[model samples]
Target chain A: MAWVLEDGRPIYAQLVERLQVQIVSGAYPPGGKLPSVRELAAVAAVNPNTMQKAFAELEKSGLIITQGTNGRVVTEDERLIRGSKRRLARRHADAYFAGMEGLGYTRAQAADFLRAAEGKGEAEDE
Target chain B: MNELIEIVGLTKAYDASHIAVNNVSLTLPRGKIIGLLGPNGSGKTTLIKMLNGLLTPTQGSIRIGGQPVGVETKAHVAYLPDRTYLSGNKKVTQILDFFCDFYADFSRERAVGMLQSLGVDPNARMGTLSKGTKEKVQLILVMSREADLYILDEPIAGVDPAARDYILRTILNNYDPNATVLISTHLIGDVEQVLDEVIFMRYGHLVLYTSVDNIRERHGKSVDAYFREVFAC
Candidate 1:
């Protein structure tokens, strides 16, 4: 995923969110070795110190673990991964609902819209 | 060991009317990519020159690694001036040789590798290359040195957007972790993400010096936005 960051938040906080999404979505597979702080910082075009800080935040939540000298890896725990995935999904859904509310759509209408869009997309694919 | 460069009450007065820098004091630790930011005529260049021992401070003192700025400190600092001082008649290879001869820490192989990657021809004359390419060559030369501190004055200002990214990447990937890189620039938005800390100057006075993330956290805006607010006319 593109590490597009906004202007209003801490860079490390943004990095933390991006890495969390990557881990949960299997872009960085469970048990997969994460790139070194320097490599990832170059890729993200951010300071390595900020990347290190983000990794520390992830390690605190058990989403990733740092080995003594071998570098860090995404958590291999299936349950932890699933929980993180669900939390991220819930956050997106909450944001969607809030946006739909601002557009004068009720929660039921929003759900129906999702159902309708999914069915229409399936029909078009067929 | 933590503090790589220290400045206390540093001031540079050109005359009674022109005070370029005034009573600035700060300590920069090693392993940080710090942004020296300010509007035009804010004494950013003057402060950098003083750090490089090119300009003597009228008041106060600067100690790099506990030693005053002189020959010893000069050997530890790699400076890239805002303007090009490389001779137009010299080929890229000759310039590389010059750096190798001048700085004991300069790595010719590393410079060559970087130049090849950037598709810069070593046989080409300095005057024949584009302004952006010249700046890239200068940056690569400076970065190839294994110095304790790198002072780059507006390294990215003369380059294009894509080249800016390359410069930032080069800075991120290169350099020793124990070395401190101090880059002075007005393009805050472009370099803010790459910077660990930033020192803001305003009309020869030190306005603020803080971590980049701290600015976003406290001001609820990016460093660029906050800078506009702080230095707005």
Candidate 2:
């Protein structure tokens, strides 16, 4: 997955978001090995210390764990994946509804939009 | 690994009574970029000179790669002094040849690439180049080496903002990861984001030596803001 950096936000926060998205999407499947700090820093074109800070933050949140010499690994805990997915879904719904309301759409109209979205999803699956 | 550069109770005095660098002890490890910061006449140059073996310390010792600062250490340390060190009559290609002959670690390809990218003609004499271009050439030479330690004093000083960024990027991209780089400059704000650690000097004394993260955590401010507060007149 591609990394996106939002303007004015701290780089570490963006890194955390990117990793979380990867974990929730199963890109970094359960027990997968994450890239080393030097590798990530080179890829991101950032300082190694900045990448280290991001890794430390991830470790603190229990999303990943590092083993000596073996490098960092994605945690296999299912609960973390479920929780992150729920949080992301809720945020998306909130933003969608807020935008619809700002554009003068009623609750009923928003529900209709969701039904239309379901139809499009089914069509794409078929 | 042992300290790549070590200074123990080091002091420097230009005159008999006036001290440039007070009693200071510091151990700088390899493979890290160190930012030596201070205001004007804060002994930053003197301290850097001692590290580069340009000036002998009045008291104490400086060891590089476990050996005392001498001809052996000098060979391993690439230094760019605060003031101009090259004569105007010499061409850029001549200096490059000189460095390659004198220092075993000088990389000719890297120097040529950097000079080309910087728009510095290799055949142009130092006297013919503009001040900013000259500074860029100096930086290119210093960073082209695969030395154990690289000491640069006021590398970006007197350059325009655009050239300053170019100089910083060159230093960042060119150096060997295992080499230690000590850059001494008063422009903290310009270089704070790239610094892993900072050494602040004041009135010939080491006022502070700490990581950028620790400083931010303690002061709730960026290193630039902390610097203004600490060095304000």
Candidate 3:
């Protein structure tokens, strides 16, 4: 999976977001074992403690659960996955609206653009 | 609970006016890699020097393995200074022999292997090698010894990225699991991943010393990020 990091955001939070994206994208299927902290850190070229913090955040968010010896595994709960996706969508929406506002576009104009984009997305899906 | 090295109110002064290391107290345990981080002129070098008996503490005492720093403790300590200590005219073989003679724990086989891997000839004179090669040779010599404490000061400084990787990998591969390695450097981001604990020093005083895990938990930031924030004026 690709590691996406923002300069302003904390490293661990970026890690958590990357892991979440992977999980929601089905790269790490439900109940599948996630990579160890060291392995993830090596892959992302980040500190192991940062990876550990990301894993802990994942656990706290109920997206993953750790089992002794078996290591951390993706949670089997569909609701948790959907919730994360919704949260991600909301964050993107917020950013999109904020950008539109900065560009002097009204809320109605932004909504119209989003609707057109959604229609194009539906056509592509079909 | 497992204190391998301890310092209580350790203070070192070069003169009556200037203090190199202020009243510092800390305990370091075995089986951990510690990053002694600070900018230049910060007492990291002085503190490390005291640990190896290169300099005498002016006021306080340091205990290694429950005993004070002395000649006996020197046997168990391996030190790699920031500056080049080996003579430029000496051959690698001559240096190896000197280490073997002076340190009982020095391993000739390991030194040869490390040198061979780096494409360094034991017969070659130190003066002929590049600066990076010299640093690698120095690291090999220090790591070849089976010491309880390895004090490395700025091992990656003045080297290219590739050499830095090799030096870091060599330290990781050669270090004894039971021993403690204290590395002092200003390059925190590069070595932060491997470090178990980090000690931050500012102007000859230790500002922070805590586990990496604790730092992340408390600050919600990577050690590098936290360092930038802490040191930012």
User: How do the candidates rank by DockQ, highest first?
Assistant: 1, 3, 2
Q: lDDT tens string, model 3, B1-233?
A: 47889999999999988899999999999867799998788899999999999899998899998889998899999999999989999999999999999999999999999899999989999999999999999999999999889999999987998888777767766645578889998887777666778999987788999977678768877788889898887
DockQ of 2: 0.13
Candidate 2 DockQ category? incorrect
lDDT of 1 by residue, A38-117 (tens): 88988898899999999999999999999989999998998998998898899999998999899888998887887877
> What local lDDT does model 2 show for residue A109?
84
Model 3 docking tier (incorrect/acceptable/medium/high) = incorrect
lDDT (tens digit, per residue) of candidate 2 on B85-159: 898999999999998998898999999999998878899999999999998898889888888998888888889
Superposed Cα deviation of residue A101, candidate 1 (Å): 2.2
Model 1 chain A scores worst on lDDT over the 10 consecutive residues at A117-126
Clashing pairs in 3: none
Task: Estimate the TM-score of every prediction.
Answer: 0.95, 0.75, 0.73
lDDT of 3 at B111: 93
Taking chain B only, the TM-score of every model is 0.98, 0.96, 0.96
> What is the TM-score of candidate 3?
0.73
Tell me the DockQ of each model, to 2 decimals: 0.80, 0.13, 0.15
Model 1 stretches astray by more than 4 angstroms: A121-126
Worst 10 residues of 2 chain B by lDDT: B168-177
Candidate 2 chain A weakest lDDT stretch, 10 residues: A1-10
